[model samples]
Target chain A: MLEIKNLHVKLEDEDKQILKGVDLTVPAGEVHAIMGPNGSGKSTLSYVLSGRDGYAVTAGEAALDGQSLLEMEPEQRAAAGLFLAFQYPVEIPGVGNMTFLRTAVNAQRKARGEEELSAAEFLKLIRQKAATLKIDSEMLKRAVNVGFSGGEKKRNEILQMAMLEPSMCILDETDSGLDVDAMRLVADGVNALRRPDRSFLVITHYQRLLDHIRPDVVHIMADGRIVRSGGPELALEVEQNGYGDLLAEVG
Target chain B: MADTAVLVAQVPTVEGKVRPGQAALAAHLDALDLPRGGFSRAARQDAAQRLEAMGLPGARDEYWRYTDPAPFNAARPEPLEFAADDATLFTAIDRLHLVFVDGRFDAAASDPLTAEGVEIESLAAADAGDDHWASGLYGRLEAAGQVPVKRPFAALNTLAAADGLLIRVTGQVARPVHITYRRSALDADVHLHHVVKLEEGAELTLLESGVLGARSNVVIEADLARGARLHHLSAKRAKDPKLGLGHIFARVGAEALFKSFTLSVNGAMMRNEAVIDIAGDDAVAHIAAAVLGDGNIGRFHHDDTVFVIHGAERCESRQVFKKVLKNGAEGIFQGKILVKPGAQKTDGYQISQGLLLDEGSQFLAKPELEIYADDVKCSHGSTTGALDETALFYLRSRGVPRERAIVLLVLSFLADALDEIEDTRLREDILGRLEDWLTERAGNPGKA
Candidate 1:
């Protein structure tokens, strides 16, 4: 469902390269986890896939379901079924969360030649999806992510994912600021959406999140490259021994 | 004596007569036949003298530094014709609808001037009767507000304005007074002066809408007595490129409440100035304006000058102004909060913000806070910025198109000022207009 080949990205204003020739692929119906230490270009890879500006892709390609995402705008990529759950959800004042969600849902549907959802229909569907994430009605009525707690913001992102039903979902540090209970709730939301046609690329520094949403394959990323690929056991190995031995072995 | 008269002019003496750009003003004034035998003959004479002394604001004036007064100085503006298709807002509500065509009161189109506890009469029809309630308030507030700052346009309106509404509210009125202006002639130049007086403990709401024609001047003087409440809302549509100028001079009495909000859209040039004086203790005054200008057709400039005075102890004042400019549009905001001596415990808040859609657009804001009272609480803020990039990216990443995202952000920027409206239905009505403007600008009617 998602493919990346020799992806090299650099800051637009500076010569510093963040992602250096990284190659990875997650086939349909599979969950992949990319584990790395600090400065391993984990977040950069997610932003590059989502088509954020101010980043120059110096080399390689990224495709979603055989469609090149590098050429598409951020919103076009979203309509093509690529969702990036940001590590820091932006607080947009004066825009209600419910309205934002409805706009996003209808926009994607309209782009795909689907009929727009009525307000009543949207409200029902969002309520049902929000129930699973435990997001109350008050939170839905407030401005988008304004004054929201870290855990609430993550849950809201998951709610969006459920509503849009994107084929490829990239969870970037979703568990970074969440507590134990919030993490469990988020894991439950993601576990419910797992299906045969959908895939996920879970990027995180800790293996704790992997315990909830177990990955079919684990890739150890270092120096902007996928150095090793293995099963779920690889995450446990790294968690126990840390990345010091792994970096030495790669060197 | 000639030298003394020149000294009285308070400028570089060229002659006994303080004439700078009075040629154009004199031509315009010569054409306007002054109404004879009114209650404010002396006040009108004084204002006319002041207008002569301080000619129309020039490029060198301190307050008119950012705004060029050349457009408003034309001898006679060539009317720019426009067909307005949008229906007048707030028509469904039950209220006294007074219509003005080409700045003249259309008695046939207006409702009968009769209501319980309310007296409505046109200044043109009201004779110079000493018993008339409006005679006292005709030009009282306008004259009082000219101190420390000279508003020549308002002074000119005080003298030449005859076709305007005079409203007196003695008790609580259930219906609002809706004043609508319609332009029938393309070359019409409208001048209006309105007076509103609320008796002690009275309450009333005033609604104003319509697009004044080429080279128009309007001044509304409101006097609120003790414990009275006045709510004023104006939605000025700019369908054509014309020079629309307006001034609001109000004196709020002790324990009275005065709230006013103006919504102005695209125009070639527009200026709305508000001067509010909180005279009574424990009174509250709020003045806000939201402006949206489009420079796609031609040069668009809009200015909002607001002055809020906290003159009594424990009085509160708030001034909120927001502007959205796109495609080389220019927006100017000059706001000041003044707290007089002995006005302790005065709470004043002022905020002016602008959202620039592109690089060509400009926003100029001058915010000032003058406080002589040591125990007062006053704060002011001014900001000019583009739409938040991070917020834009977030919205786009969620599948909202770029154009729709920008519209949402722009609306968000103006939300605080819009929220100042006291009525829900009126707020929604104005919100709809804003969304329509955004949709038209986006050129995506179906999507936006």
Candidate 2:
């Protein structure tokens, strides 16, 4: 459902290239995991795909179900069924989490010419989904991530994905700050949202989070390019040997 | 040419006949012949001299940058000929009534409450013997620097103010007193001076409402005693699309609390100036205001300036101002706080936020603070931005439609200021008016 062909992006006014000829594709009913060391361009790829500013797509194209994703604005891309679970979600003061989620969901609906949900219907839908994710109703009433703990904010992002139910979802370092218990809860939330027609690209630094989600394919990235691709056991091998073994092999 | 010359001979020069407004004001000042003792009297004379020297504030004056007072150049409103009948105005605000018509107190409309150890009487009736605080504390709150270069209207108010309210609370006053200055006549100018003395540990709340017609100018002076607390909330809802100006001078004693909320919803040209002085340690003062206008309804201006003296340690002061303008309406917020050398541990915060509903609307916010003390926490922020696009989109996405979303967002933007009012009844009343204004805009969306 998602395809990126020889994607190259650079800082707007600088010669430094952040993403150098990166290529990836994920078909329906499959999960892909991209593990990389610090500054390997994992976060940059998510930002570029989600249409955030300050990144110039020098060459190549990113398409969702054969539709161009690079040409759309961030909100438009969100409406087009593209969701990026930000590593550091913007803390929006005075905007409640439930209010923000409803706005985003209804905005996408409006863009697609669908009837909007009433307050009662919205409350019912969000409440049921939140229960499965173990998110309390009170947490939804607070300002969007405004004083939320690290784990709660990540869970809130997943809650948004469940509400929007995007065609393609990108999890950027979702496990970076989670404790063992919080990581398990986050992985469970993501697993529950998985479907046959939906796809997820989980990015992380450690193999611990993968123990719960169980990706079908695993890719190791080094220096802005994918260096190796293997089955789920590859994650186990990397966990034992560390990125040093992979980096030496790539060199 | 002969007819033109004859008309020129018949007409009086600008200097010979005081512009009708100026002439009436001069006559009122001459009639008062205020004694030299009281600060109100001395301040009046000083303001008059400054008015004579500086003249009316025109477009050229930096302080009058957004609004032009020249429209008031034509006819000066005389004090109302008859006592103002305030039955209609008093009903609008549900509280104990204190009525002042044409700058004179009306005893018939006042309530008798002596058991609470609170005295409410006209300044004219106040005795000099036992009412020592009234005379001693009166005019003690001095305006810092040279008194502001007087505009003609202020000079006029200083000159004409006569009998107003003198509220003295020996103990806590449970109920708030509603002071209504109702202007029914077309040409009416009322000058008012109010003295409020709260003995040690006393508390009082005063609600001021100004309802006036065409050509009205008013001024007020207030004083608060040591260890006392006072909250003043004033709202001006003027009709006739004429001119109205109000000046307030207040002094707060040591360990006292003074809080004020001023709202200007409709006016042709309205200016509310407040100068407050914090004289004692542990005192707190808060000034909050909200103004809204559209069309040729004129401009609303507020100047809140505070002066904190030395030895007033642990004093706190804050000012929050918000304005919404549309259809060429203009709003201005100019605030300043000065901290003296020994005023350590002072906490002062000021914020002014505004929204321009249309391209033609304008807002100017200036917050200035001067601190001489070493250990002080003082900060001010000003934000001038259009409505949040994301917020609007979020609301519209919920099937609320675009116009309803804008109304809700605008109301939410103003909710912060409205939430500050301690009285729920008054807060709801203001919110209801705000909703009505928003509804009117929603009904006629095209005009905006």
Candidate 3:
């Protein structure tokens, strides 16, 4: 269960406000999609929820399973079962993908006061997860996101989501630069990890990705606020009409 | 010009002005008795006079701008009381060990000096001989390295080194030769010089570890014949407050390969200078160093000065230096590539990067390219900055703690320099050690 109550946020270095009194809720086992035009504060909502720096939360509260998230660090948020799949996966040279995954997995486990996974166990689990996503062993051995194509970066993010197994997954514009086949592959990867206790906040501009993943609900956001909420058909309506009619109707 | 001065035993005055610090050099030399009447007797005599005329470095010198040379030129080594059990870095491999304690060879602690396809003789033994095979080679390359720059410490070592190894490899040596330097007493100042020669079609890997002493002036002069290959790797992580000066001079022949990499973790002051000359076509030479320093522990300052001369056609050279400094530590790099007239088809590259964790830490670099040839490719770059904030956020968002993420980023930054190591096992070993160092200090920014 993820809940946002009248969330307000502004840029740390500027006077611009990115999120304004947005309210939303996602029950467990539900997939919700946010469809909006450009400059709709879609990414800011995700970043603020994930505890990323450079955002000052002026008001409201965000919580995962009744635990406040704004007070925790990014790593603490990750350990608390909140995962944000960055739209732009950072290219970190010198650190291999496999190493990053293992370290992340072990770190979360340790934070939760669980026994850390051994090297062999972590390697086996990552190999199994990567196999389903068609990630080759060579890709896992290279530096994280270095020399990776657009689709590869997205797939790598899915691999990370799978490894983390978070309770609330936020895909921030994950389908922007992805092609059809690549989007389907990524959707399948995300769909495979869906469980009864897991919830997803898939943020995207198009409805094709929702067609594959099959979101249960959709929300229309504009000017840093969500104006309307509806079922899956709402995504198709916005996709066909291009958010013009929706924004005007709400106005 | 300095080499010629050694041959003539006279100061090669330039522009009718003598080198600075000669008076200071004379006063500094008055405190010690130089090694005399050895197999390298004439060479030592000439070097002493040459060093007198050239003088030791000072704080105001151009090349010594980033690093103060007063420590190296001090009449005696400052007292460094810190000590630990010195260990060899290559214990995972089957290699011959030559241990030196306080500038003297410890025969009981060292392996036998006999190896197949290789001949090793201590400087003590070589000095006893009136005529020796190393007579022409010893101190020759060091003298030659002094032409475009002044390396007074190396000259001082050539004149007064008490004991070192004289190695000659005629065939491929399967095992590496590891030289471990250790000091068992305080206030130990050592002047040790080593001479290494590789004949045609020969190969050898040399390894050195540990700090020489509280104040150590060390030199390794290498002469590589045609088709020869030499791999030199050193680790200086005494974790103590001390000063060390090291020089590596090599003369490479046609189709030869010379690669040197040094990993310096923590030291009060360490200066490494490597000068290489490509005497024949189709040779390749690479010099790189990965340094980490924390001034909070004591005082940390590391400098790497390199000069690569391409005198032949189709020769290649590379210089990679990466440093991570925190708590007011400083790192310096002065690297240059000289493409002589008609030295066409030269490929040279140089890059230096520093990741400073705090406002007090700094990295200074001087990368130079002096090329007279038209058909050549030379690139040089230097960068210094803090850890990438985005990368840090990415790692932290993935559940890695803030401290551990910093260490991981540092390992990533040094990956390019570590890649210069061709041996996988050795590289991994060094990587593991680099991690330990970072996790110990760099991981905890304010912790000493």
Candidate 4:
């Protein structure tokens, strides 16, 4: 469902290159976890796929469902079924979470040439999805992520993911600021949406998050490239001994 | 009191001290004629003397440096085509309607000047006889407001007003008095003065809207007694580019509450000044403004100048001003909060912000605070910036279009300024008008 070939990305303002040359692919109905240490370009990969600014994709290509992602705008990428869960969700003051979600839902539907959901339908849908994530109505009515706790922010991101229901989702360090309970809740929310036609690329720094989600494939990424690919046990191995030993052995 | 008589003498004298601004002001004032205008003679003459002493604003003056006073000082304004539309605001709510056309009171178009618990009369029709209530308030607050700053335009307006409204509230008025202005003549220059007086334990709500004319100079003076409450809401809508200069002079007594807000949309040049003085203990005053200017449409330049003074203990004042400018439009805000001696526990907060939609737009703000009392909390902040790029990208990444995201963000940025409105319905009405302005120019993000 997602493909990247020799993807090279660099900061637009500096001479530093982040993603030198990376190759990866996730088939349909599969859940893949990318465990990387600091400066390994895991977050950059997600941002590049999501069409965020401040980065120049110097070489190679990334695609979602056979559609090129680099050429599309961020909103276009979303309509093309590409979702990126931010490491730190932005705090947008004065914009209610419910309004933001509704706007996004209708926008995607309009882009796909589908009928827009009515107000009542949207309220019902969001209420059901939000209840599962423990996001009450008061939280939904407040400003988007403003004054929200770290756990609440992550859960809000998960709620957005559920609302959008994209074909391919990238969770970029979603567990960084979450506690064990919050991680479990986020995992449960993600697990509930695991469908046969959908795919997930979970980017994390530790094996704790993968313990709950139970990825089908685990990839150890170091220095802008994936060094090893194996079953979920690869994460357990990294947790036992850090990436230093694995990188030294590979070297 | 700067020797208003000696400054402009009918006959020249070798010992006369000629102020620099008065010569050009006298020359400008020469082309116009004065009249009685059906107002209290003493009040009109007092205002006229004040204007003569201070003179009109000049570009080189310190206070007028940011905003050009040429449009306001011109003897004759360039005529504009009158905008003939029936979309006068405040029609959805029940209100006592009073209409004015080109600064002239339109009796045929206005509702009867009779409401329970309130006394409303046309200033031009009311006889300025002895013991008249208006005689005490015609320009009293205005004269007091001019001590620290010279509002020559307001002084000129008081003397040249063609018509006005005199409203006296003794009890809680059940309905708001809505004053709407309409311009029929293209070259019409309108001058209007309104006064509202609230007695002790009284309450009132005033709603003002519409276009005055090609050029308009207006002033409204409000006096609130102890335990009185006043809510003043006004929205200026001018389809045709015009010149508008307005001022609100208020005297808030002890334990009184005064709140005023204005929403300015389009104009070639517009300036609104508010001067509020709280003399009684435990009084509360808040003045806010939201301006949207698009120079590409008609050379937009909007200015809001506010002065709030606290003279009694435990008084609180707040000033919130926000402006959104695009297409080379310029927005200016000059706000000051002054706490006098013995005014302990004075809580003052002021925030002035500008959101420029593009590089061509500009926002200039000067926020000032002066404190004399030892125990007080006074804080002021000013900011000018483009929309939050990260927030915009976040919204876009969630599948919302870039333009739609921008509109939403703009509305959110303006929501803070609108929060000062206590009435939910009036706030929503103003918010809806602001949203329409943003949506009309949604595609013009002025960025890549």
Candidate 5:
């Protein structure tokens, strides 16, 4: 349901290219994993797809459900069923989590000409979703991610994805700082949210996360380009042999 | 007349007779048929004399350097005349009320509080007693000795003040007193001299809400006694297309606690000045203020000044000021904390922060700390910045529109100061008004 063809992006007001001719596609009912070393443009790809400012798309197009995602604003893209779980979720000091989530959900609903949910209805829906994710009700009353722990912040990202229920999800480094237990919980939350019509592109540095959320396809990214594509066995190979061998093979 | 004469005698002669402009102001004061020896008469005269000697505050004055009062000179204000029908402005708040129209007390509208040992009388009636604190404390904490007066509007308030409120809590009264100042017509000026004396171990809460017309000026002076605690909240709402000016002076005694909260929104031209003196040792003072201005509307200006005297050791003082300027509006803050030589172990902290929503919006912050004591912990900081782009993006990506996200950010920026207020009703009331102001701006762009 999501496609990025020959994508080339550079930092605004600078000549340094961050994403060079990157091609990726995730069709309906399939999960893809993009594993890469440091500075391999994984986070840049997510930011560019999510329409963050300061990242200029010099070439190529990113489409979601056959609609041009690059032309939409950040809010519009989210409404169009595109979700990016940020590596570093921002702390919105005064905006409570419930208020922020409700605003987001209702904005997307209104954009699609659907009736808005009342406060009671929203509370009921969010409670059910949060229960499956193991998020406490008290955390919903606080300012969004103001003082959340690393595991809690990542779990919050999954909670948001479950609430938004996007058709296309991009998990950026979801397992980077998580402990074994947190990683397991987060992967479980993601697995519960998966559906036949939804697709996910899980980006990470290690193969430990691959053991929990088994991907149908795995791709190796380096120097702003995807150089290798294979089955999930490639992830196991990379864990044993490391990226040093893959770098030489790609060269 | 005797009250005026006593005021003139107490007036320092360092600068001799009042200047021409001050003479005009004094003439305006002479026009008011105020009762003799009222709360503010002598203080008004003394302040007028000081303003005359100091001359009008100009850009050269360090405090008045950033904000120029020249725009207020377009319209000349006449002596305030009491209006019988000006009581409509008090409808928004429901409390035991005391109404002051055109700087004179209105007994018909005020509900007398007659708790045992607690006296809530008019300044005119209170002055008849031997223990009147008005004459003893008015204008005692003004910074005219150092900073001097350069603003013409403040000079006018000094010259025009008349009747006020005197609240005396004897043997520890528990209930709160709400003082409401309502401005009716344009070009109208009112001055209030409020004296709150808490006997040893007495506690009181005073909420001051000022509602002004297009062109209005108000000045208030207050005092607290030993071992007594007082919490004061002042909210100013001015929507007139003309000028609006406000000034406040207060003093606290030894071992006493004083807290103040100020909120100002929608004024063609507005200024709220607070000068506080911690006269007694072991006394504590806390001051917090929040101001929001729309750059597209009439110019909105705020000048807040604080003075702390460490008369006794181990005194504590804290000040926090936050301002939000949207559109092309301007926000200004000036705060100073002083620790005396013998006042060792004094703890003082001051912080001023401003958020500019648009490029045309402007904010100027000046925070200063002056210490003479060697064993003191004092620090001051000032910051002016725009909304965080990353925070904004995070909210927008979650489906919140840009405008709603901005409002949330602005409210978060001010929550720190608002949380410091102790009165739940007053805090909620201020928050409601802030939401109303934000809603109005959000609904109608360029119509501040």
Candidate 6:
């Protein structure tokens, strides 16, 4: 469902290369996890795929379902079924959470030439989805992520993912700041949305989150390249020791 | 030579050399052909004298530094004969309609001026007697407001008003009085002066909307007695090359409440000045304005100058102003809160903000607080900033289009000022108008 070929990204203002000659692919109906030490360009990889500003794609191609994602605008990418669950959700002071979700949902639908959801329909759907994530109407009514706890913001992002129902989801360190209970809830939310056609690229430094979501494949990323790929047990091998042994062996 | 010197000596001496625009105002006043002996001849003569002495504001004047008053003093534009389509802004509730065309009352289009506990009289039909309630108020507040500063345009309006109304409310008014000013003539220059007096415990709401005229000068003087309340809202939407100048002078009595809000959009040049006096103890007053101006270079300008005076103990005053400028549009906000020596326990808050859509746009704000009272709490803030890039990115990443995301952020920037509107329905109406304006601009490239 997702493909990246020789992806090389550099900071726009500086001559610093963050992603260097990386290749990865996530097939449909499969979950892929990328685990690496700090400064391995894990977050940069996720950002490059999502089309964020301040990063120049020097030489590479990123495609989703045979369509060139790099050529599309950010919103177009979202409409094309690319969802990024941000590690730190932005705090929008005046845009209410509910209003934000509804606008996003309708905007994507409109971009795809689909009939917009009515307000009542949106409210009902959002309420049912929010209930499972433990988000109350009060949080939904407040400004988007303003004064929200770490867990609430993550859950809200997941709720958006559920509502949009993207085909390719990128979870960028979604478990970094979450407690055990919050992580369990988030994992449950993601697990529930797992389907035959949906795929997830889980990027993290720890293997704890993968325990709940259960990735089908694991790749050890180092020096802006995928160093190795193996089954789920590869995660356990690193967890038992550390990336020090792997980094030494790769060098 | 001796005779000429004597004649020149007889002429009044101004503070400085008369500006070209100021010298032309006398000629313009002659063309207006003001009538005599309507409400207060003395008030008219005093105002005319003051206008001549003060002259028109010049670029050098401190108060007029940011805003050029030349257009307002220039020759009036030829009338716009475009008939107003049925675009009603205040659809929240039914209201008593009053129509003015080219600054003249349109009796055929207006509803009959009749309501329980309210006596409304047109300035043309007002009793000329000195004992009338309006006589004491015709231009009294304007004169009183000029103590700390001078407003020559307000004085001009008072001196040469062609038509307006006098309203007296002694009880609760269920429906708001909606005044719609229409422009039917291309060469119309309108000067209207209105007076409103609310008796003790009375309540009233005044709603104003429309394009007043090609060149218009309007003054509204309201006096609220003890425990009385007045709500005033005006929505001014004028296109390019038209000029609108308005002034409001209100006196809030003991335990009285005075709240006023204005929404301005798409004017070549527009200035709304509000002067409020909290005279009685425990009185409350709030004045807010939201202005949107988008046009070519030097074509759009909006100025909101507000002054609130606290004269009694424990009085409260708030001034909130927000402006959205795009495409070289210019916005100016000048507000002051004054607490008198004996007016202790006064609570005053002032905030002025501007959101410039591009580098070409400009915003200038001067927020002032003068407190002679020792035991008062007063704060003021002013800010000018571009849209939050992070917020914009967040919205866009969530699938909202770039244009819609900008609109949402702009609306959020204006949310605090809109909350000052006491009525939710009316606030929503204003919000809807803003949204429509933004949506239209969104479709036009290079506007955002």
TM-score (C-alpha, index-matched) for candidate 5: 0.87
Q: Which stretches of candidate 3 lie over 4 Å from their true place?
A: B1-20, B85-88, B442-448
For candidate 1, what is the DockQ?
0.85
Give me the displacement of residue B179 in model 6, in angstroms: 1.3
Clashes of 2: 2
The candidate scoring highest on lDDT is 3
Writing each residue's lDDT as its tens digit, candidate 4 over A1-251 gives 99999999999999889998889999988999999899999988888999999999999999888999999999999999988888889988777788889999999999999999999999999999999999999999999999999999999999999999999999999998888999999999999989998999999999999989889999988888888899999999999999999999888
Report, for every candidate in turn, its global Cα lDDT versus the true structure. Answer: 0.88, 0.71, 0.90, 0.88, 0.75, 0.87
The DockQ value obtained for model 2 is: 0.07
Residue B173, model 1, lDDT: 90
DockQ for the candidates, in order: 0.85, 0.07, 0.87, 0.84, 0.71, 0.65
| Candidates sorted on DockQ, descending | 3, 1, 4, 5, 6, 2
Q: Which clashing pairs does model 4 show?
A: B254-B280
Clash pairs for candidate 5? B56-B150, B57-B150, B57-B151, B254-B280, B281-B312, B295-B328, B295-B329
- In model 6, pairs of residues that clash are B78-B186, B79-B185, B79-B186, B79-B187, B80-B186
| 2 versus 5: better TM-score goes to | 5
Model 1, range B135-193, lDDT digits (tens) per residue? 67777788888888988889888888867888889999988889888887888778898
Docking class of 5: medium
CAPRI tier for the interface of model 2: incorrect
For residue A32, what is the lDDT in candidate 3? 97
Interface RMSD values for all candidates? 0.7, 6.0, 0.7, 0.8, 1.0, 1.1
Residue range A1-251, candidate 1, lDDT tens digits: 89999999999999999889999999998999999898989988998899888899999999999999999999999999999998999988888899899999999999999999999999999999998889999999999999999999999999999999999999998999999999999989999999999999999888999999999999999988899999999999999999999889988
TM-score of each: 0.95, 0.65, 0.95, 0.94, 0.87, 0.92
Candidate 1, superposed: residue stretches over 4 Å from native? B1-13, B16-18, B127-131, B444-448
| Model 4 chain A lowest lDDT segment of ten | A91-100
- Per-candidate RMSD vs. true structure? 3.2, 9.5, 4.4, 4.0, 6.5, 4.3
lDDT of predicted model 6 = 0.87
